[model samples]
Target chain A: MTKRGRSIRVPVLARVEGEGALEIDIAGNRITRLDLRIYEPPRLFEKFLEGRSYLEVPDMVARICGICPVAYQMSAVAAIEDAFGFTPGPELRAWRRLLYCGEWIESHALHIHLLAAPDVLGFESVLDMAQAWPEVVERGLRLQALGNRILAVLGGRSVHPVSVRPGGFSRLPGPEALDPLQEACRAALETARDLVAWTASLDLPRETQDFPCVALRHPHEYPMNEGRIAATTGLEIPVSEFEAHFEEYQVPHSTALHSRLAGRSYLVGPLARLNLNRDRLPPPVAEALAATGIAFPSHNSHFSIVARAVEIFLALSEAVRILDDPPPAAPALARPLQPRAAEGFGCTEAPRGILYHRYRFDADGRVQAARITPPTSQNQARMEEDARLALERFGLDRPDEELRRYAERVIRNYDPCISCATHFLRLKVNRR
Target chain B: MTTIRIIGLGSPFGADRIGLLAARRLAREVRLPPGVEVIERDRPGLRLLEDFTGARAVLLLDALAGGIPGRVREVERSALLARAAPLSSHALGVAEALALAEALGRLPEAVGLLGVETGPAPGPEDVDPVWVQALCLRVPVALERLVPDRRVAGCGGRIRSRR
Candidate 1:
């Protein structure tokens, strides 16, 4: 018995959402071991937010991840607003929903067109894909740009745009500022329809997985800003009861904390949402998704690209509707947080999936403990399993080039954002 | 005869990856007296080390995007080693693929830095005005170090913040 090839391990991965690794033991059968670790140090916003002024929660906890800054902002604002006990006015809610739409559009497009699509199309990186499938890459850039444009119009620059506070936005976008967004949203809706159709047209392998679906469930609309945590197995609970239902276990083999529902593991994000609330999707978006020939409860993880494309259409359609009647000028926030020892739960549908944050603030505002559960962290285990499943399904006898793409596909489904400690995405600073 | 390899970090299309562009300009100005090689390796790989073997020194240039905007980190090999393992795997990023070189102890003797700060702007792909400006100031320093008495005019906008 000979110990085959060298064992390689990545303790921390780059160009991703959080830390993860790939280790392979190639004997007769290549042991493709992939662990999507969430290496982000726990800041414990939940314990820290125990007694602090609730208002400071947004700014303080927003540092969790750059990719979904607004998600954090929205969750903190909504929860704190819930505690202080006031719902944002109808107009404010519409504006908040609009901002969320931009995040979904941008993040979903990024995952689909840039990260995942390249892998499916037989390219190592998007840069490689750009040479052969120029049109596809262009479409991604255009769609991503549209998403970015929406963020900029409402908030500022797409990455960590400054807008949306507890009560509302920092400063409401002027009517004209929203006008171009309206136009862009209208055009993007059509673009998204085409994108979804195009994505469905790809030859996707099928798998039948019975993983429990986890997502926020809304009565009237698709989940985004607020809803109870619901499972496809008929389990529904408030976000505060999240811990009661799910537990995060620390594994020495990986950086990310693995999550499980009580005694079982579950899946979330795009697939989960579509499965749970396909009927709630807007008419146009739903029709576009159906046109893609994809159905709900799609166990094939690769179908996430189709799910993302469908969400992009929903985002565009929603954005246009919001822009049709912009929220009037109003102070971005409400009264400063009232300080009292308390625990508050916040959750939102990030572009990737459900991002949960719990803030326990001391009487003043010093963060006592913060638990920021990013969507990527939750998806880590599933990603690793997907990689192994892909290898087993495809047979490791195939070339690394072909197998590697599917490996990347598993990772892309989580839309891993390696920087969960910091709340921004795709930041490149140039000081000349 | 020493060889220098300039591997571009970050997505070239991204608003980062300007470090590669700066390294390219420096490679043009600081030609070896006789036996020297320049390589613009894109992305990450183990083959990048083939250029620096038996060389007196190597300068790895790339982009860094963090902190108070216009700040440069003159990182030493040791500083990078603390981040990486066995000192050799720190070629590109420690968190990425490195254990291959670390076990071999095949690290270059001398390593230099030409890291340029990119402050939330468009990065260098074909060419960018912002990256070219920073390179103008840093390129001369690089050439002076590699080839003494060699001089080259800086191009890209009027030079300022020359650190």
Candidate 2:
């Protein structure tokens, strides 16, 4: 029985790395409502973060999700160092960026080859992709494994890593350790460039949007670990005022709180980063963008897969370059922390997008309050709004599995980490 | 290496951690005798495989979600053995790690699985059910194969050989 205009939902979303659901309300021809509900059980990371020592913050936040633990670690340290009013030296900072690049290369490849491309090409999962496109999946796996290898080299444990501390690393990695990664990054970057070109030409639904894009910006380099916050609409603010402009509230359909700016929602992460930082992208990547003549910004979330691939290219190149100039030593971060009273905010560009962490420590050095805003939660509202717009523009003629597939794809694009979204994803209807 | 231990698997926080719950209930209610260790893990990952090696007998308690929901079923640990590369971040899932160990000629004398089926969308509170308790009886039921004696109390811990 071919059922038309019926919306579908998957209890667990795969590929983009966390758990989430897709809700589409289709009534005959016109689509009434569409929502990508992220119901990954709320761990309330930020609220739970209160009263923990600075040392424990990194460990506690890492458990927020398995997919992007490094993102959590980077953001936490940034916050910690900011709170203590210290900046990392050049060599140390380069290592941080290198680690982030590994994450980006690995994560982007996972999304491109395994998740997004499969959806476009009509495969159930990466498992299925392996049977059909063996080489592509193999390359993807090798790339992912290499990233894990990089993580294992630096972080101690690839998944939850114990290597990162306050000022820099517990110990600087040896040059020999960084050599193999450099070679892998070089190969992976070339592969990623080819992959991006292939994905950009795929027939996606024609849904260009006008999103209020936000991302980290650096005048000298592309934003990965450190940068000032900037938006497409010319709203630049210090990371400290993050909470002042943004608000998070829980929605009826989900436990996660959706975030918005001054009552209006904004988009973050890959698409936003690509649009806002197109200039900062490496020359080859910039040229790739130019060849497409994608003059303006991208609003189509489907193109997110393309953006991820391009990022993989940039990340691979950047990582190799950083590794080439190995730091003098893994800086000495073996500081015995003391109790302190202060407030600090830190923002880092995680693989998925902007990750922000803020903390207020008491005299005893215990965290009085801790707040984390990961990329997925920040993109929740934008995802739902994207769905509504897609329904209106694409014409909801979802027959049978098509509706479910479309919704799943939308959630997959943000790679909604419902686990992290648990801390955020506030939804409320505005009848303006 | 002379003694053997059986550990249950499942997570209490995860929606389908009931298998571990049942295994824990048995040991607590009926004290496990000497030379036999009963342990529980969220899931027997690669790390658990190392701990399980050289054991005479091992049993894993984990929930499997098939078409059947809330059905307590028992099978050999080998029955669930599906070999794939350890693609997960974990060193191994129970099935593959054990199979790999076996292929490397370090197989345990006896291995078993007590898979409890759970619902599509289970919650943290899905452990307490009449079916779950009834499923717990499978350990004793499975012990029937190992020990011929109908004696319910001792469940024959130090069996001589493969009965």
Q: Which candidate wins on lDDT?
A: 2
Please tell me how candidate 1 rates in CAPRI terms.
Answer: incorrect
Residue A167 Cα positional deviation in candidate 1, in Å, after optimal superposition: 2.7
Identify the runs in model 1 with alpha carbons over 4 angstroms from their true place: A1-19, A24-38, A41-56, A331-333, A399-403, A418-432, B1-163
Query: Predicted candidate 1: what Cα RMSD to the true structure?
Result: 13.3
Clashes of 1: 50
Task: State every prediction's TM-score relative to the real structure.
Answer: 0.68, 0.71
Worst 10 residues of 1 chain A by lDDT: A1-10
How well does candidate 2 score on lDDT at residue A334? Answer: 42
- Model 1, span A195-238: residue lDDT tens: 88898998776755557778899888888999999988899998
TM-score of chain A, all candidates: 0.86, 0.88
Candidate 2 lDDT over A296-401, as tens digits, reads 4887778887788778778777887877777676354445555479988889888778988888998876888887787877888888887677655655654535
